[model samples]
Target: MLSYGVSKSSSRVPHIVTFCCNNPHHPTTTHAESHSVVTRRALSLLATATASVFSVPVLVSSSSVRYLEAAAAASTPRFSELPESGGVKALDLRVGDGDYPVNGDQVAIHYYGRLAAKQGWRFDSTYDHKDETGEPIPFIFILGSGKVIAGIETAVRSMKVGGIRRVIIPPSQGYQNMDQEPVPPNFFDRQRLFTTIFNPTRLANGEGSTLGIIIFDIELVSLKHL
Candidate 1:
């Protein structure tokens, strides 16, 4: 049997959209708004603390949002691959042999999430959390139903009951506009939701930034369907 029930390789992503308001300076609204034509990010946690929230805490360091823009006319691309087109990347860390899930299936999992950077910290983990009975709290969600991030849904569908995979969720697929960058017209509602859930203190402390990429380490615990 797979504890709860069921289930990377190194990958780097270049910085995408640059923002003006995501900085430390409380710049004049007039100046900031002028530059806000295209920039933004946020996390989409659940309604309550106990709810199966998907995601990580974040970090920020550069107080130079605008400065960096000035420093490099578009920072040099970090890696050779233009990963944006991939939408989400799921690198198999461990393959499992249990039943794989199909769409509409209810799934359970244990996950550890963090920023996609080398210095990123493990912000949230089911293994680290236990109920009064000392049992780890596994997250239950319906597969391919937008219950979690798009990347997570895609990754879980490919896994068996006991597999482990490292999933990469771009700002577009993860928290939409947590970084407050330019996204699609349709995603505005999701962006607003995450903005409300994101912790300002964490951002201020350089723990995570708005609209940043998310790195998730997922283990498939079990599946109820398919």
Candidate 2:
């Protein structure tokens, strides 16, 4: 399984075993042959330590090895594609407890919005918007209010408080056809951007019609029942 660790600089990084097998007792033939005698000795020591932890003898079978690999794969993040929503996909970076928000519930979130067309160009980020005391200002809206884009609202509907998700939104569910209120705290710039996207001439030429895929890294900070 993946182990996330924070460094002194507060950067998150994964620490994983040297091999996917992760069985010190039975090293893969390829790796075993390449390693020096000293490395083999180290693996032997690790096997001894592992045995001490579990009194039962560890049997390495093909089925057991496959199970271990599958378990490790499950620990990694994978996108769950939503059907009938124009190919919208969401990957939960952090899953939270509690019930998901329903209609009319007020939800607040901090998000990093990027555009797939422009090489993941970050269009906006709530983290960049800070209060006077220096706290990031979350964007809040009532669920199903239609104030925000469809993709964002759809993803938030399934998120619980403290859950973080990365959503991929196709143009159809984004700013292609409908008009949405400008997102704060850069309302003016966002308004201008949306206005351009909604322009008749631009839409006709397919210039801004395909708003391109939008990538949102959204954190459901909190929710309140209406």
TM, every model: 0.48, 0.60
Candidate 1 per-residue C-alpha lDDT over 1-226 given as tens digits, one digit per residue, 9 for 90 to 100: 1233211112222243344566766444554443333222111111112222223222132343343333233322222222443467776666888999999888998887665543554456677657899888787788867646666776777789889887767655666434432121235534444543354765676645433577777899999975
Misplaced by over 4 Å in model 1 are 1-86, 177-210
Separate clash counts for every candidate:
31, 0
Pick the lDDT winner. 2
lDDT of 1 at 101: 94
Identify the runs in model 2 with alpha carbons over 4 angstroms from their true place: 1-76, 177-179, 182-184, 187-192, 195-210
**Which window of 10 residues has the lowest lDDT sum in candidate 1?**
41-50
lDDT of 2: 0.67
Taking every candidate in turn, the Cα RMSD to the unseen true structure, in Å, is 17.8, 9.9
Q: Which candidate gets the maximum TM-score versus the true structure? A: 2
State how far residue 179 of model 1 sits from its true place (Å): 16
Residue 43 shift from truth in candidate 2, angstroms:
24
